[model samples]
Target: MGYLFGPVLSRRLGLSMGVDLLKYKTCNLDCVYCELGRTACLTSCRDRFVPRQKVIREIELRRAEPFDHLTFAGSGEPTLSLDLGEIVSRAKELVNSPVAVITNSTLLSSPSVRKEVSAADVVLPSLDAVSEKAFQSINRPASGLLAADMIEGLKEFRKEYSGEIWLEVMLVKGINDEEAEEIARAAESTEPDRIQLNTVVRTPAEPVEPLSEEEMRRMLEIFPGAELIPDWDWCVPDRIRDRLMELLMARPGTLEEISCHLKIDGSDAIKYCKIMENDGLISRRLHGGKLYFHAIDES
Candidate 1:
């Protein structure tokens, strides 16, 4: 529960358990519509964000749980962690579930990073733009990244990675939505196993609106094999819920903050918090019109 989040039902991967490789807000891009809010450390450097041992240990411990996929995801970017490949290799040896990494594909240009992700069962990489200007406006990636280089990296990864590769395109109303043809062209270049069309379902760090369902369907048509995945699931395993509550109690968080940090939905986080409060496992405090949760014993 400390580094790992739920056995929550995911539309893409059923009963996915998450592993946070980097600290909160450590990422390469400060995306406009990120569910996790602003990026605090928006650098492209690959370093040890979380100690390697801790991540491996958590994966080992969580291996006993019932999860369909063991995902490398969290509040920040997973690919930014220098030891990502080793973590994926170690995790594969430790668990029987399919291993996955949800990456923004900014670091895929590096051969080492591509090699690391190749060990996983599936790699879900994001390609929201075809042109440099659109990429800059949509992802708002760190200073060093070039959309062309990132696309090249994805193309390279497809050749080296034998595992399934799913390309994720997050559609923001006025931004990337207008460039559906370009986006589809870019996706075709990568030749991913699946093209996943997604939209902003949670509150974003910046004020960005979600695209309409009709627009999403139109976007899907552009990519022949692509599918639209609307965010809606909320179920969490009882044991995983208990573990998540324990972690949240140790560190207080707002509903938005909790969902962002945990990579779960806001309503789901709120529901779990209420259940924990009713069970006398945790308590909440109202600060500046927003509720913050903490352990009852912390008082």
Candidate 2:
């Protein structure tokens, strides 16, 4: 499962199976808020970094889970894989689940890259900055990757591609958040199906903190209709995934507490808890050696 991970649950895409294309940290940008830390490859070249047939073989092995989407994302930007189109096409042929790809929008400038990714059912590209200065500071993209070109690529992509484009904007307090108006302008120009605003929630490569919920609310004022993405932990759901979310929406719990709250056996409680944990739906913390499970903010 080197290239494949999870039939994880996400608020945006339910029961997703993640497919990583690029090797760990092989990216076009060394983003300040990257959860996976700094880029080791920091490349713009498109090649078969990993064997295409091998990845397809991996997918064929894990076909039982009814994943909502076969998401092309990994330790880095998916567009880095030159064989992305073939991968997307083959995955669709192998599985009934719709294919999706989460790209950083860095390689959209390449016609081949854009054409390759269009095979996906949905494309989620990001725009954290419309201005070059902001782009350099926040994303630190590869040399010669202009902000203007990336923006234009997205705009062109909007015209050519028919799939749903949900543009993501990741905010850091003093970095990109201060330029919300510019980000909105980019969003308007791109005209995606919807805009999703997000902030860092986990340990980052750089020293930065996620914005407060209140701050995110203020940001909504600028983006107008954009939705704020909830910070989700990996949840391992049991047989009843919906019930886990419903119960956890009220409050977080330990397996014992969740068992009591849902009136289930303690043995069954731990089993469900472990499932939800693996699914990335809920996060756990240890207190006095007891593991407590808590659902992340789904709003």
lDDT of 2 by residue, 1-299 (tens): 57888766555665568998887879999999998999999888877888888899999987655566889987898898888999899998888878999999988888888998899989999999988999999999989898889999999898989999999999998888888898898888999998998998868899987888899889889999998875542234454577777878777776666778777765456556656666677786756534567887667
**Residue 45 local lDDT, model 1:** 86
Give one digit per residue, the lDDT tens place, for model 1 in 68-153.
68999987889888898998999999999899999999899999899889999999999888778888888888897998999999
Query: Top model by TM-score, which number?
Result: 2
Clashes of each: 0, 14
> Measured by TM-score, how close is model 1 to the native structure?
0.77
Show model 1 residue runs off by greater than 4 Å.
232-299
